[model samples]
Target: MVELSKARGSYVDPAPARVTVETWARDWLRSQSQLKPTTLVGYESALSKHIIPRWGRRSLSDIGYAEIQHWISDLSKNLAPQTVRNIYAVFSLVFSFAVRDGRLVRNPAEGIQLPRRIKAKRGYLTHAQVHRLADECGDSRTLVLFLAYTGLRWGEAAARRQRQSIPALRSLFMLSV
Candidate 1:
């Protein structure tokens, strides 16, 4: 009869666990290709330069509020408020995905406060400039005026049809013109 070695109280595996912040973030980005090209590029840039380096190796479940708070504090010291807020937004996406994937029970980003930034005043077209712009567009005058007045997005405005009535337009779309 061959003798067998006895096992310990509990079986233990020596393999290293694989879940990490970077992997989760990469998966999310890959899943978001439906977003605009510029938006995808922006996300990739933020992840490469900011979000990944700080929290990449951390397991999704291991992160907590205090850890995020410290990171936010440290970021505020070195980055402008707007930039820090953008960085935090990237972290928010990662944590949000973690919760959705069952990797984490809760999102650590939920209660973390972001630094507030004062936005620069926007520059509007002078009356003369607006008139000149409308004239220059010629056939496209209506589209330009519509964009400036109503704030309808470029895609939605471009999709409008000529036969669409004013009442229908008022309800289906608001004309900036």
Candidate 2:
């Protein structure tokens, strides 16, 4: 019992280090004020559909590279490449927060291999097709023609106001036959 008495002065209680993944994840989600509404919704979806169901109850210290790699491999068999990547990104973010808050020494989600997303081939419209599209659009013929000719994205076209006129738009419409 003499050794116990000798060590008593040096035996300071270590800081509480047993935070569950769910607790940290909730806190992390709550703290993300800068994220856009759509992005926030996506993050929540990923957590609920994938990460939280698998690892939410585990402590941060209990997770490791092997466990994460295995989980990702299992996910890849059924989920799409992009979906798996999105879910992994959410998991990585929670671990990153843990590291920043001193709950973890490093992010376990880092450096894991993920399936590459395949790009779909884009189809280009011919002049005839553009004219046909404009004709089919009826009342929005000008808008359709403008979009087809200029290749403006849907959001960009939707945001354009008539009051803020582009001088080049008028010139572009004078198509020489």
Q: How high is the CA lDDT of each candidate model?
A: 0.74, 0.81
Candidate maximizing lDDT: 2
Give one digit per residue, the lDDT tens place, for model 2 in 117-145: 97989998888888888778877666777
Clashes of 2: 0
TM-score of each: 0.59, 0.80
Model 2, position 44, has a per-residue lDDT of 97
RMSD of model 2, in Å?
5.5
Please report the TM-score between candidate 1 and the true structure.
0.59
| Candidate 1 worst ten-residue window by lDDT | 8-17
lDDT of 1 by residue, 68-176 (tens): 9898989999889988888788789877876666555567888888887978899999766765786699776666666766788988876877677344544532433
Prediction 2 TM-score vs. true: 0.80
